[model samples]
Target chain A: MRSHPHHHPAPDLLLAYAAGSLNEGASLLVATHLALCPHCRAEVTRLEEIGGALLEGTEQVAVGDDLLAGVLARLDEPARPLIRMPDVTPRPPPAGMPLLPQPLRSYIGGDLDRVRWRLTIPGLHEAAVPCRGGSVKMMRIRAGMGMPRHTHNGDELTLVLAGGFSDADGHYLRGDFAATDPSIDHRPVADADGDCICIAFTDAPLRLTGRFLRWLNPILRT
Target chain B: MADTTEVDRLNGLLLCVARQRDRQAFVALFNHFAPRLKSFLLRGGMDAGAAEETIQDVMVTVWRRAGDFDPSLAAASTWIFAIARNRRIDRLRRDRRPAFDPDDPALVPDPVDGAMEMMLVEERAALLHRAIRELPAEQAELLRMAYFEDKAHSAIAQERHLPLGTVKSRLRLALARLRKAMSGDTLGEQA
Candidate 1:
């Protein structure tokens, strides 16, 4: 477990998360962030209290006469665990700080060694994370590597897993969350000290806004 | 407003089931919460049959995971509501709800030590229940739509024909009021 993270999800995102209204990709990002940020987890806990209140206050419709009996009958049967065990290897992650947190680690199917990274360009590698409703991708940028300038066609949420990255908005270190929208267009470069690994959730493919990459955007669709 | 006694009673029953695996205690809990869970799931648009099935599943989970519930961290109602919410998400949506696994090594520990902080959280739950009830009608209604209907704020804004910012601000205002109400009591105790 790491220390409290400096960057956090926006209130609306956090609220949606607490409400259980966010899609899978977004929820994954928030859950991973929540693992690292106690403040947000507390906020979520409070909001969930509201959900509890609403559940209590809602009009009660008696369940079927047989429902309780049915439940009791099967109480002794083996049940699935609350948290699903994603198919993951037992191998420990690489030495030092873990790049992928729990939930995210399981979602990625295992540790960093298990990730099958493909080169998007020299010095930059990308891997698609399987999630429904939107796209999630993990990226690894070599030290001092700068991504092509781009703007989200829809909102993009990035959680820094290892090392750091900096863009027009600010520098994002491990566990820091950065949310970008179509309104913000800028290139992000990895900190010079180490390779930066981050997972990003995007509702829509990014539009490469860099002057040179602009023409290739149609073909890349990333 | 939730009666503290009633809340405590439910908490005790849950604890009994947790500690003794007492069938009688589980039965009492199932009776009380099953109806409420049914109502909650139906409100979210589940068909009657589906809601019933989900309630049974939820109740079974309640029985199984009773040991995991900590009264200091959450009220019984709040904990059950979360379980129902996650169950609903799984039943209704194609996407999985990714949740933090507490046992994961990468999981960050709460900043404050557990006991005191968790107790404060329980107190906050009671205050928030009342605070929600006390929110201006429109804000309360918006909160319901966001939660029960699982509608996005943007969707709420469109449905209400109001600016998205207006909807967000009202919700924010409602939350701020709740926090203020909760802090009022805590601050008094501290001073």
Candidate 2:
């Protein structure tokens, strides 16, 4: 089994998520984090209650008389199929597939086995995860390989999916969430024990600062 | 009074709709929530017709999904608010709301005992309602903009002419205070 996360999303990010104000990529990152972290899940649940209270506190506007009847009229119509919540018991991953969580799994179209990896450098493999207003990509770094030193111009969020990585901030295990901005400049190296795989969400392209990798920035653009 | 009893009644009404397919109970649920939802959407800048259409969709989903409601897990209003929030996001072409499946196997199970946790959530719910109502006007306004305006923090900073850090800090402060208030009561009870 994968290890639990030690790091978490920031409070502001969590609040934005509970308020449903985050863009798709950020929201996707938070949702995946929530799936892995029960504490944040509880925090989000409480935050959502605040939304409920705000919703309840709104001044009531009398609906048109016809509105209720219209909704009621449709009650007897066939229920549209919903992508309802799954059952309570755990379901194993598809045979031979890596254990990928929901929302992320759905976004990726399958588990890690399905990823069509492109070799970005000698040891780094990346597969783009489609999202608007930002870039989401799954990265697979060979054990002991280090990413080029870089800083973000806009916001970037990374969730560790498997193995581990360590930078100046700290080591991140499966389910750890790291929120990085322009203020942070560090290079993360995959753990030597195994290949480190993670999904990264960035609103702007990262500015690579390594002497040799600087020119490779264009290839990294979302 | 909108106290715990009112909260329970709403939960019970939804359950009635779920178990018996009781139209009267559904009507009760709709009457209480629909008008509030309409006002909320309008405040969020949706047109009246669209708000009405969205409300129709939301209420219908509530009816169909009522069986899924577990008051111990979430209050009735909270459940409905999530539905409305998702529907609004969809109607607005605001970014897709990525959602985690609650029952996913990778999910870390809550470590606390279920019954004890439920009690705390119930207690927190009451405290949260009061805390929000009593919050200083500036903080309350920020919350409104975040929810009703559906603006990102950067957008809010731009519109309010506050620095981005200030917008983020104030929001963080507001939530921190609300959380402290909720947990304070629980701490006191334990003491």
Candidate 3:
């Protein structure tokens, strides 16, 4: 596989990839990488086999004899519209924007008008990235505003749109990605002045810090 | 073995439920993986309610993206753990929680330490569980503390109240044993 020397999935991502937990957008990104990076793919495959062996070793959890019947009954029941698969197309960049990454472009199919402007932090502004797949949002941290130091509840893939940010690991610019392991700590502050917009795909709500800041998080939710 | 087959079949069924937007399948999947996922969160230091809420949200995600599962690439449990891991990290970042760096010298996996690694591999749901199960108990315990708990040699030493040098030596021996084990070589043959 051809490696993009410039991009590499974080180790945590590799583990997640091995485990099969990444969401569609991020998963697609890693899948694309696996297509290109044979080493990573090999690691993924080994992890899968290892994971399989582990599952095989686990003591089986006893289930009621009716569990299959229960599942089948559930399957037979009427389906709901609660979960909708969004059309996987890319939104258009603002006028005159340079070509976007394939992963980013796939989700932004030529629509820039519908993105609702939400709020702006010092150098960043949050906007709802419209999608048929539940609530998804896009955050644009001005070259300088980036993001405040933070952590997450689950996996987050911060895809850079333009400009960059720096954490302890090094600088991440346009098209550079960062996958935080659940165990590792980080403090990512955006570029000095230019803006870096990131598409943050998350399954849960953000939990901001401190009593005052925590209370304000609700207001910040779009 | 029957249970394994059953779980695999249930996974297939769950996929179908997810694709069809079957709320019950969604709930079933939630109920199955939620507790395990919450344990993962609690181990990572989340309070009970927060862990429960995190589990609920992750299930909601499983409900939403059931169609996304690609059977060719991973099993249901692996896929679920991947989702759980991501959600856990995202929550931590949003809350500005500190991350644990595995590369810190303090956090480094001793190349010779197979004991803890072996034991962790034995833990169910870990991809390498069985491989580790074949190891002797002493080696397995050390690997478990090192790999599963993300502990440094010093920490392990402190926990066991052993001399730091002794801890280091054991870790080194453990890693050597694990490398041999992974390569399909026996410790007896090596000795």
From the highest TM-score down, the ranking of the candidates is 2, 1, 3
| lDDT tens digits, residue span B86-185, model 2 | 8887778545788887766666666656443535445666777777887888888888788777779899999999998988888888888787766645
TM-score against truth, every candidate? 0.91, 0.92, 0.41
- Candidate 3 residue-wise lDDT, A125-170, digit = tens: 6776443223446677765553544556555566555566788878
Order the candidate numbers by DockQ, best to worst: 1, 2, 3
Q: Write the per-residue lDDT of candidate 1 for residues A1-222, one digit (tens) a residue.
A: 346688889888888888888998999999999888778887887788878878877878978888888999989998877534444565665466565777787787777877899988888888999887789989999999999888888899999988999998898988899999889998999999999999999998889988788776775575
Predictions' DockQ, in order: 0.66, 0.62, 0.07
Question: Which consecutive 10 residues in model 1 chain B have the weakest lDDT in total?
Answer: B113-122
**Best candidate, DockQ-wise?**
1
Candidate 3 has a DockQ of 0.07
Of candidates 2 and 1, the better by lDDT: 2
* lDDT (Cα, tens digit) per residue for candidate 3, span B25-131: 66666556655565566654577767666665566566556787765545676566555655665565331111222222222122343242222222222213434
TM-score of chain B of each: 0.87, 0.88, 0.56
Error of 3 at B21 (Å): 2.9
What does candidate 2's lDDT look like per residue over A138-207, in tens digits?
Answer: 9999999999999999998999988989999999999999988999998999999999999999888899
Candidate 1 residue-wise lDDT, B78-126, digit = tens: 8999998888888888457888877667777775554424245446666
* Residue B156 CA displacement from its true place in model 2, Å: 1.1
Candidate 1: where are CA atoms >4 Å away? A80-97, B112-122, B184-191
